[model samples]
Target: MGQTVNLKQRLAYNYLRDGSTKFLCYGGAGGGGKSWLGCEWLMQCCYFLPGTRWFAGRNNLKDSRASISVTFGKVAQWHGFTGYRLTNDGIEFDNGSEIIFLDLTYYPVKDPLYERFGSLEFTGGWIEEGGQVNGLAFSVLQTRIGRHLNDKYGIPGKILITCNPKKNWLYDLFYKPWKEGTLEDGYAFVQALVQDNPFATEDYIETLRNTNDKVTKERLYFGNWEYDDDPAVLCDYDAICDLFTNEHVKPSGVSSGSADLAMKGRDRFVAGHWKGNVCYIKLDQGYSTGKSIETDLKRMMIECSIPRSMMIADSDGLGNYLESYLNGIKEFHGGKQPINPEFDNLKSECGFKLAELINNRQIRVVCTDAQRERIKKELSVLKQDHIDADTRRKGIISKEKMKEILGFSPDYLDMLIMAMYFRIKPVPKRPKAKLGDI
Candidate 1:
């Protein structure tokens, strides 16, 4: 006799029953039993179909080992498939179906993994953290599911995805598709929250509730994706554009610069040059090597006709490497350090300054289609909460807000925020008094 299933598990089972369901997504609050449902559903697929091959993946291999593999191990044991071999990152079943565990962290490049894995023609798959995988990566994985067609295994295969809502790029790929009712073409989505599971202990649910911060509480529990009651946004797109067009704005007289450093895979460098309140963007979307970034910077400097000291570069994460490289160049060639401040701190200070400038009618932005779209999609999402409720109450809604309202992720808008942040004034310094004149 099979073990009795829970309500959430039954929903997942029903979705799996319709072999036509190409994609199955279950997401929302934590402790919703989404992971458990996913494990049991995958196991059942492997059990019922001979020669069926499935892959279960997460954001990282370590997580795959600890969560997906471990959970599936217990489920397999309960379901009488005890002799399966749990290897480095996979579980092999007795009847030739295998559950291979993979991670996105191992492969950041979006398309290559698809080319490599898509060749295998997997019968089915599951993405554990649907929120983390890039849309391109998820799309690539989806292509790999249609090689075999047996009566037992069904046709077109299927993919099971599980996630909690996060305001990242993946929102458009999975959440929006299903939420908008367009998923009927190739997918079916089901929302599961902690409150939906009866077996989940009240204490556990309350614990999650207690531990969740204000943002998490809003996003996870209530599924509210609005601007958290925080204040940090300095300018609203509508206001910026309005002020610029109405002539109630001042030009900062400072130019803007953006930098993209090369990483492990393909690198596309972009920078925008602004002067007297006009922006001219330059894009370099091609192969860039580690040795060529300096050359690229020099070319950008020439194009903008700005001294090396005036340009600002992103120096967080891989950006640190670029910073170190520029510092090395200063020591060897220029005999002075280039001004590349810590991106995050600089961004905050710039945001604050921009807010002040906007409040005083000292700055203007052109409402160009590119600029408006970028602000609506990117800058709108970059706000941090203000401590005072009254203060936080003002300004445009955040990306999370837009996601709840619009049902899509904002990536291009984020890049626009970075561009704006790069142009903010350097940290204020104490003014020097004239020598001997107090």
Candidate 2:
């Protein structure tokens, strides 16, 4: 679909052409010619240096065949790689240079999945949908960078990535530092929103406009760095912020809460401690391992005063490791039986119950504006489902769905739910009088 490269594409090409940097991460929004930049850069390298080798792929092999194949095929004729063998798996250039298409799905998230990359080497590579690949995978890929091609041609090993504005490992690795003006040397990031692409059609622009959700609007069209908003938001973000403003409310004497734990990568080890109606977030960070989170929990217990007994930590997924290590902490299984009839499971009950608390002005979150805003963003994307069965069935959106929507797990919101549900009181009954009434 692209006959000519745009301005942002030219900028990335210049960086690669000049050999000004070893890494170039391009494109922020869709239709900004990011994938094109990756392919073009590969073509330029192959043209200049004979027998050059490269690897190009996305997280899903099937998607690679469907989308990237067409993008590469369109330019293969112009670049004289026309004798290539194109398939669902890879493309082989006629010049003895190879572009191996790796389905990174070969490496899953848990355990030592990315270690498989140690078996292969490449001169350079490009990761499409860079958000899907984890940091560990990227780190391993970095080792394979300088191994595949010759240096006599003056083409240094390069790694290019293309992705939308998603808050994932990419955000932490590239965007955050870039935003802070402290992005390390030898790396560059070029952000191209939809407005930057003059080639964007009015019809496509209208489609992005129809998405009324704030995060979706900011991301797909405006390409702003913000949370992804689903159709069903558990709580009103404005209402949650308002709770912090009411000065008449006092902290209750009892102190309790719950936690959502992650050993490392993707999820965070988060805990929210409740003092009366307010929840204070003591742990909401990432880039850790099983051993580190346990240590952090123990340290936070002493420093932040988090009551160990009252906090119920998530017991599913990696949280199992956290539960076993954190002494005296309660375990919360989201799939367990729900206390309310309207909910399909304990997780659903927790979400709806937290919504009730927020709606009634019965809860508050004591934190910095940034913390509150982050919590609100996570809360706003919590979706719900109503199964159309003969008997009504209500369920909270699975963490997997939330992950797809936000590009990562909702750690803080899960902690918030667990903590508030811990404070839910059981119903009471009046004492019965003896037979003296007779």
Candidate 3:
């Protein structure tokens, strides 16, 4: 096509052609020629590599057709590549190469695991507006690629993702790790801002610049992912992430243990040992019996020098089994009446306090990268439900709703919030620092 792309697009192309990188994340800001780059690259690959199957996907089919499909048509016209017919579901080339379009919307009741994509085969794929799609869909897409014409054509499995700045799985999996300089092997990220695209029209640039909305200006114009304007959100996005790096929040107050118990299923049992505002995860594992959880909790308390009186466990459901085994331990009743009349229940009171501590940079969480990722995802959805209803009591979104947003229950994050119980109703005297022993 002899079309010229900017430097960031070139960098993404290099990553795609290198064969060593399996995932390449391209665009951050809007109008960085994201759709064009994705479309042009997929079309060229379809023409040059015969008999290879590719997949193009987005949050929904309508979005794909309106944006990505139109861009693909423009790319084909620009390159003068003929003999390819667009079907309702995909595009087919005369050379037997095809690109199937897919809608990656997640429906909990209909297709929980995204099994509809399980039987597909593709050499590569491109996910447009990846920020809008769920992580489970992306994961399912990963498994379906590299299954068609890979060995015969000597092409590696590659998935190109183009999205504006968003704090979803892509941010957790790519941008944050990339910023930390610890991006995993076979993953490459190239950040492209709007100003980097020379092909962007001057009128378009001026319109973006003239926008008055702070969130829109920060996200689309400056590519800032940290600014979130959702009215329901209780905590700041950056402050929630800073839980791992808040070094100034020293360990000095009470040394307590908190656990959110789950037994023999997909839910996880997460326990943490806290020293003042800093918490260290003691145990985070799946499928635990009551006896096993009691044993582990006992061991962790002993290891951390946390007394039975200072430890607390969830009193709901299976946690009752754990509380029964351990006498004299405090039981956290999430449904109980709150100490503060302003809140709806114990969980809501604690949730608001947790948000406050996190936003104020008073909480610190020391855990693994995987745990940190889950914590970020969970805390990002800590919203003040029914804020405008004066008759309704102030509360956080229900656990069921949060579970729908996150694929699993927010076990680790719940443990952190449970630890805030001590802060809500403190002991008569704060315990001395025992960091040396822990």
Between candidates 1 and 2, the one scoring higher on lDDT is: 2
| lDDT at 313, model 1 | 56
Over 1-438, each residue of candidate 1 has an lDDT whose tens digit, in order, gives 175566776777788777577887776667778777788887877776766878888877789878987788677777776746788958887887778887665343454444556466677788887766655556777777766544444466788888787545445555656666665466677777778877779988787688646656765676543323233545544455453454644445655555544443443454445454444555443556666766677676677775554555542344556657655221111112223343224334444444555445554455456545444444445464443565332233443554542334443333233444544555567789988878
Off by over 4 Å in 1: 1-6, 77-83, 106-114, 149-152, 225-376, 380-428, 431-438
Where is model 3 more than 4 Å wrong at Cα?
A: 80-85, 94-96, 203-218, 224-231, 241-257, 262-311, 315-319, 322-328, 336-345, 360-377, 384-395, 398-409, 419-438
TM-score for each predicted model, relative to the true structure: 0.59, 0.69, 0.76
lDDT of each: 0.59, 0.71, 0.86
Model 1 global lDDT (CA atoms, 0 to 1):
0.59
- Give RMSD (Å) of candidate 3 vs. truth: 8.6
lDDT by residue for model 3 (121-171), tens: 999999998888888888888899999989998889999999998877788
Clashing residue pairs, candidate 3? Answer: none
Ranking by lDDT: 3, 2, 1
Candidate 2 ranges with C-alpha deviation above 4 Å: 1-4, 18-20, 76-88, 106-112, 210-214, 229-276, 281-336, 342-348, 355-363, 368-415, 422-438
User: Which one wins on TM-score?
Assistant: 3
Cα RMSD to native, each candidate?
A: 10.8, 7.6, 8.6
**TM-score order of candidates, best first?**
3, 2, 1
Error (Å) of candidate 1 at residue 76 is: 3.0
